[model samples]
Target chain A: MRAIVWKSATVLILIYVAVMGFLGPVPEREILYETIRNLYFHVPMWFTMTAMFITSLVYSIKYLNTKQESYDVWAVEFANGGILFGFLGLTTGMIWAQFTWGAWWSFDPKQNGAAVTLLIYLAYMVLRNSITDSKSRAKVSAVYNIYAFAAMVPLIFILPRLTDSLHPGAEGNPAFSGYDLDGTMRLVFYPAVIGWIMLGVWIVSLRVRIRNIKDKMYESSL
Target chain B: MKAAYSALAFIALPLFTLAAKYEPVTWDKTFRESGKIFVVVAVVLLILLSVFGYLITQDRRISKIEKELKNK
Candidate 1:
């Protein structure tokens, strides 16, 4: 019953955001114009991704302490979901930038920082695959996951705020809040963030379940 | 016929309220200015649908594998 409600809520919220995001009224700023609607989709991807990465970091730390294989599986799956969200965020950002910033890859500080953060997480995955032994693999990857997440936090959240970034709410740019003072967009924006984070977690949970099943099968075979 | 138009009015009511919340000129320039935006909307819809479909199938496959393992 709880699961049904969760699933229904996730679906309903996403549908509402999708419909309302497109039709929603936005402040017609000079450059953003209609493209500001990308806020609902693009910005939330990063927020969702960041939350997933944080979950990965927690699970990684838990795995180190408890030495539980399930914890490692949870960590890896959350990272996988985060990486997927990162890619979606990057693509949508590029599309938005192409229209607003007049180029696909502008090498802005925020853009560069985002790319590096994604690379750090990608390296964590590659590190996981290098080891053959399951126990060692889990241990090494968990440590690396901790380090990668530490680096990612600074790269995405801190560095962007420190530099003059083309992205909004950066050193040189004003945030969406300045113009969107009416807060109508917040209606859909908050829902979009919640919906995306819920969906990302759902995906990570499914992946972890599959990994657990695979581990069981392997153990039985042995 | 009367009910249908009223239904339309009910739906459009919120949207109009949305428009009125912001300046008319700004709304006109952003939303009404571009028909091409619907193309972008179409693309986004397609991507979202495909993503949801993939997740559903992957979920089903995982559930099937888990069931098989359980029976064994």
Candidate 2:
């Protein structure tokens, strides 16, 4: 029943975001124009990615403490979901940048940081695949996941702020506050973030469950 | 649930008020004026709904498999 409720909430919130994102009033800016509407779709990608990565980090820590196979499954699947969302966020941001910032790849601090963070996560996947034994694979990958998440926070969140960046939320510029995201945009933006996060959690849960089932099948076969 | 109902009510109220208001910005007024923008919204909504349908079906299928495995 709870699962159905969240699934319904995800659908309903996204439906609302889709409707309001297109027709809703936005700040009449000079360069942005209609593309300001991309805020609803673009920003949520990173939010969802970060949420997934954080969940992955938690499970990784849990795996380290308990050495449980299920925790390892949860960690890896959550990381996989995070990686998918991260790439989506990067690509969508590039598209938005091409229109507004006048280049597809602008070598912005935020862009570079995001690329590096994704590379770190990708390396985690490679590390997991290289190991043949299950126990060592889980331990090594769990440790790597923790470090990857640690690197990710500073790379994506902190480093971008230290340097001058075209992306929002720099030293003086703040995201979801000040002049950029006003009260009206919040109506859609907040819902969009929540909706996308819920969807990400749902996907990660499904993947984890499938991984568990696969493990069960393997055990029964053995 | 109550939040969803309130949001629906908010959406319903805005449909009428949206036509009466005008702003000084250049935001594809012609498309909006012609009511063709709703076509775009409709298309997006359709895609979203179909995606939800797929996810829900997948969820149900997985649940069925899990149940069968438990019974076995």
Candidate 3:
């Protein structure tokens, strides 16, 4: 019942965001103009990605402490979902930057950090794929996942804030300073974030369930 | 000639001032005015719907597999 409710809510909320995001009133700022709408779409991808990665980190810790295969599966699948959203965020950000910042790949601290973060997560996937033994693979990759996530937090959140960045919320940029996101914009922005995060969770759940079924079949075959 | 020149300059001064206020940014006022932005909204919504549809199908397929495994 709760699954159906939340799933339906996700659908409804996203549809609302899609329709309202384009039409919504935005702060008629100089550079952002219509592109401010990209906040609803682009920013949420990062929010969802961050949420997925955080979930993955928690599951990784759970797996390490409990030595449960299911926990490991949950960790990997959540990380997979995180990477998917992270790519979406990165590409959309690039496209937004192309028009607003006059270049596709500005050497902005945030952009560079986002790229490095994705590469680190990609390495996590590669590391998981390379290992052959199940137990050792789970244990080793869970540890690696912890380190990858730890590295990701600083690369994405910390270093970007410390340096001058083209992206908003940097040390010098008064981006998203209270007046930037007007009440009308936040009406759609918050819903968009929640909806996208819910969708990520849904996708991770599906992947985890499938992996569980596959593992069960393997065990039965033996 | 001097008086005519002064009158012409006085008339042109307000015209220059009326040209436009300095706006720091440009926004697509026409895009919203002509309602063409709705077309973009429709396109985005369609793509979102298709993705949701695909996910639904995948969900159903997985549910079917789960059922089959349970029955066995």
Using Cα atoms, each model's DockQ against the true complex is 0.28, 0.39, 0.49
lDDT of 1 by residue, A175-218 (tens): 55556434888889989999999999878888888789878988
Better TM-score candidate (1, 3):
3
Worst 10 residues of 2 chain A by lDDT: A171-180
Q: Which candidate ranks first by TM-score, i.e. highest?
A: 3
Candidate 2 backbone collisions, by pair: none
Winner on lDDT (1 vs 2): 2
TM-score of 3: 0.90
Would you list the rank order by lDDT, best first?
2, 3, 1
- Which wins on DockQ, candidate 1 or candidate 2? 2
Docking class of 3: acceptable
How high is the TM-score of chain A in model 1?
Answer: 0.96
Q: How do the residues A69-130 of candidate 3 rate in per-residue lDDT, one tens digit apiece?
A: 89999999999999999999999999999999999999898999889999999999999999
Deviation in Å, model 1, residue A54 alpha carbon: 0.1
Worst 10 residues of 1 chain A by lDDT: A172-181
Error of 1 at A106 (Å): 1.4
Which candidate do you rate higher for DockQ, 1 or 3?
3
Please give the ranking of all candidate structures by DockQ, highest first, separated by commas. Answer: 3, 2, 1
Best by DockQ: 3
iRMS values for every prediction: 2.6, 1.6, 1.4
